[model samples]
Target: MTPRIVYLATADARGHLMRAQLLVHALRQAGAQVDVITTSDAGQRFLAGFGIEASILSHHYAMQFDTRQNMLRGASNRNVLHYMVHPARMLRDLLRLRRTLRGKDILVNDSFHPAALFMGILPVARRKVVHVYGGSLREAVLGNFDGTKRRLFSHLFRHVVGWQIDAARARLEHDFSYAISDHAKGRDCSLPTPVQVAGPPPADGLNSAAIYLNPHFSDTNLAHALCEGIADAGLAAYCVGEGYAGNDGWVGVDPNWASRAAHAEVIVSAPGMAALSIAVVYGRPIILVLTEQPEQASNAKRATALGIAHQTVTWRGEAHDFRCQVRQAASTLRRMVPAPTAVSSGRLQAQARVDAWTVRLLALCGVQT
Candidate 1:
């Protein structure tokens, strides 16, 4: 019998949902019945194209500002109250999910929903797997610090931020956790979940198609810069998905990533974990822009550091330099190299790692994979 799996995710942003969708596809291909539980209709709609089943939960989101310097601001803080606001309803949904999977074998969490945190405390034992997709909170927290911000962060989180990560790792000890990058490891040296080195999508599939560019969320200023570069080059650029409005491009709302990506000459956008996955999966070269999010900045730096693509900072004052880099990257990509055997080998290694994880998760739930 196929294992029944529940994927927990958020709908406010498509990045996590997109990764979950890809994992769902992999699970189904491996003969598992997967149901994604998230908090938005938009997520459901996006997942529908992948033929994945979905359930909705209540959620709240805070607006993000333009710079990393702004993260120390009050608005950037997580509102613990928001999590408690719908406690009763979230509990109800958790029970509903249990009922939906009466004979199911596992609960896979990617969404960081409160229900995952409350697991094992419930009256009944649940075979659960918590897959934390982002980098280590330790890394993220440390990234937030960089000398000058360290004092500010210590004052804000009461030095409890790092402790929270330790606690989270402890709670998830009996569960399976997967990080998207190796940089996320080493911080939690004793991570309960088996760590794997699954890099984002490779950069080579770009071609003659007119690239439609969109970042992870709304990096409006970066979007404007990219659009300016594309338009000034006399290239027809297409914009879609979230945060594409008011920018110059063809109105292809609701990102059909699989299809739209095939027509992209180069994807010029911010380096989101999921967005990077799509770019690599489609073999698309990306002109990655750095963002204020600690994780995103890390990803941008890593990708650039690895020479996978070109990168630029949003706040950089040189528009001429920015345009020059864009055009040069585009021109170079016009004659980009072929996929090395190493790429397929790397992808196979990733699949193998994920397969091992699936088995571990199933076995933890008392099911044989």
Candidate 2:
């Protein structure tokens, strides 16, 4: 029987949607029927960019972030609380989800979603759910409460999240390393971070730098600073991200961005798992533009420690300072020599990993490959 799968991807960052895109494409190619549900309209548009159709759940929740990319804890809490108490929207969306999942063989929850989490608590719905997430994402959720004044609330919420994870039929944790054996002993199987395979590098040679920022960095001044910085290094910038859509000079919503970045002299992006995975596979040196995002900050540290040719530039509200930092990072990374084996070896390993994951997923859904 063909496995019928419903993937629920939250759109807090593009990484979740990107992961969903790869997995959904793989599943469909393998003759599985896959339907996608996202938390917001932005996610719908993002999936659409790759020619994938996704429906938006009416009762969606989102984290609040400022134009500078700092998480607004107070605002986020209030928003979530409001959503939780709204009986009408919550009941309606839950019904929508129940209807969607009726004939599906499995429900894959990428990262987290409140509605899915709630459904996982039900005995009937819990059996069909398989939660997918990365190590950084797990850390980010726990790290958010670290050192906060609300210690009791933080502890309780952590336990709540733990319970939700325990409720899933299975958990698939993915990372950006070759060591999948270490995590194969339990329900939590660590797979390689799934990313789209890159085509051959540009025949014309590396011509420009690729910059990708997520929608959180909506400050126009930051975009201007980034453009100036890349120009200062005498490299043309091929910028991607909804945040840069308003900037007339940058390319926005390019579905072929990974290919473009594969040909870049260097990749400049926020250290989201999707972007980082692409950089590693393509063997491109990267400059991680950091903000107050805890997950991204932790990811940047890990990437640097792992010996990736990586640099970091934290925003401090000064356009001039940020511009200078980007210029310096870009200039330095452009001169670094990328390993010859990095591209070919990484690409092959990544493909193998994704294939392994696809097979496992199919088996979990009772589909004979």
Candidate 3:
């Protein structure tokens, strides 16, 4: 029996969408049918690029931060203000969800969708909605906070934010919760869901066939810098992004970007939780995380601090410095043993956990894996 899975992912942050994508692939591999619903055009393109048709419902975005010179200054409280100012969006969102999702087969939430929050209250259960996290709120503050920011983060603010996380965890409590990595689980100590560390998913036979290397980017600015470096070096890397054009490298969208990332020789990326999780699953690829935002710098710092498989870089630094780091990363990667054996042991363990979820999800739908 093919289990029908409906994944509801919010696009405030793309990591959630990436996780939902992993779930979709895993479910389909197990012979399940899956559909995705999202609130961003970027999400739709991501799904379409990978051959996953997502229904787009452009809702008001949450967490619009004030960014300047490629740095996050602060987050806007517009979501709250909007609700207080006008209930139109909320009412519309509620009506659409209640109508379309009421009878759908098990819903999985990667973001804090109101549907997930209200599920347990209205004769429904948040446990019915699998909550996914690549990075938790606790990390957002603790990881990136400077001394002033830390001191300025009032007791009231801390209390309110902690309550929000706790409330979400309580609502979405389930026998198991999905964490992008063990590090995410470690940071989110309050998560009621016993965290299962899902390393980057296995290549699953999706080999990158002479397709040249794939360079991933969430930092479009850094992407341009890195691509410029590639061009200066006269290297031919595959640039992967919706609106990204390659310079000297070829620009093409591969549906299996994750798979390619897993098998690449060296990956130029950011240390965002999604990238870290992907690195864990991909194994052996030397990663040079392009640090731009505070959160990214923090993630990069932590990746290096924990001695996890990554190197950090500030792409905004001197372009020559950036190019030097790229060369250094590439050079270091060229030295590792051809095949991943010692590292494979850990990744295989993580893959087992992912497979365990696949089996459990199948069983949840009354199908035997």
Candidate 4:
């Protein structure tokens, strides 16, 4: 039986999508039949760029926001009503998803909790849940339902939750469950325990600086502003991402961003595991712009604690001030003379473990190629 694996990744962040993309590629390279599902539109394109087509789920989870553009609430009944009005499409989408997951050999959950909920309700054959843990499981599970949902679903909801919990326990014990960072186990936060894996290496880059920002920051124009400031300082700055496009022809979100990152003297970006992993490759100085999201904030804390990067609370400041920070960072990079570098043995071991897992999954599918 050729292994039919389904990768369900929350497309809420770029890091999640990119990480899933890499995993999907490795699986395909190993000759496994892989299907992908995500909740983000950009994520669909991101996966497509790598030749892996994905199914976009019309996520019914409502997000509460204010004038300042913060996620005041996540997945509430207050927002579900709007989508529920379209009963026909909602039912169709649910059925479509059910059909997709009913008989997969392996199901990989990259911090996508909705899959767990579906697993609870839908009868999935060979229901092997391989969780790629990233965010707080507590928040993901607890945040999905408010008081109204609990009272509405009644005891049936509790039973479903129990199944989800059992699935999580099974996933944790399973070898396929992976935690992206080597230090994830030590964090006393919302992260989970699993095989600690390192990030993929970027292409060999120059001695200049590069900035990779999440689309979330596009709301405030901070990502773009930082790029402009860096360029204004007469430094080599490659900004990889949209919203910051054109950038007065300074840079565009390039597909070969890793290659650009490989040459940079330092990196300025959000604390995504994938981006952080690239920075870790050559011990590049990272100016981490912290986000309120637990997973990213946790990554930033761990990176700073390990002496991997400097933390900035926000990307707010005048253009001149931002330029001064860039100049200072470059100066510090130069003063240091010889570049310092180190890679965790755990990270290296993690990389190897993932490769082995890929081979094992392929074998399970009875594919000898």
Best by TM-score: 2
Write down the TM-score of every candidate: 0.67, 0.93, 0.69, 0.71
In order, candidate lDDTs are 0.51, 0.81, 0.51, 0.55
lDDT of 3 by residue, 1-369 (tens): 458777788765555566566567778988888778997776777667656789865456454532212433344344644642466765566556556655555666666554454442444443344444435434553333344555565555555444444443222322112343332222123222221233353444432211222223333555556655544543445555533445334344555555555555455555555556555544644455443355556566656665665555555556677766665655555455435553355456446655655665565566865
lDDT of 3 at 85: 48
Clashing pairs in 4: 205-262, 205-263, 206-263, 208-265
How would you encode candidate 4's per-residue C-alpha lDDT over 229-300 as one tens digit per residue? 566546666666554556544343455665456456667776666666666654556676654554556667
Candidate 1's residue-wise lDDT over 88-177, tens digit each?
665666667567556766666554554554553343423343435456333664344344556876555544443333434222211122
Candidate 3 error regions (>4 Å): 1-4, 28-33, 62-75, 83-85, 118-127, 135-138, 141-221, 228-236, 246-252, 292-295, 338-353, 360-369
Candidate 2 structure quality by residue, lDDT tens digits, 70-178: 8897798787777777887667777888899998888898887777777877889898888888888877876567688989988988888778887878888887654
lDDT (Cα) of model 4:
0.55
For model 1, the superposed segments whose C-alpha errors exceed 4 Å read: 61-73, 76-80, 85-103, 120-129, 136-138, 141-225, 231-238, 245-265, 278-284, 313-325, 328-335, 339-369
Cα-lDDT of candidate 2: 0.81
Candidate 1 global Cα RMSD: 6.7
Clash totals, every prediction: 3, 0, 1, 4
| Candidate achieving the largest lDDT | 2
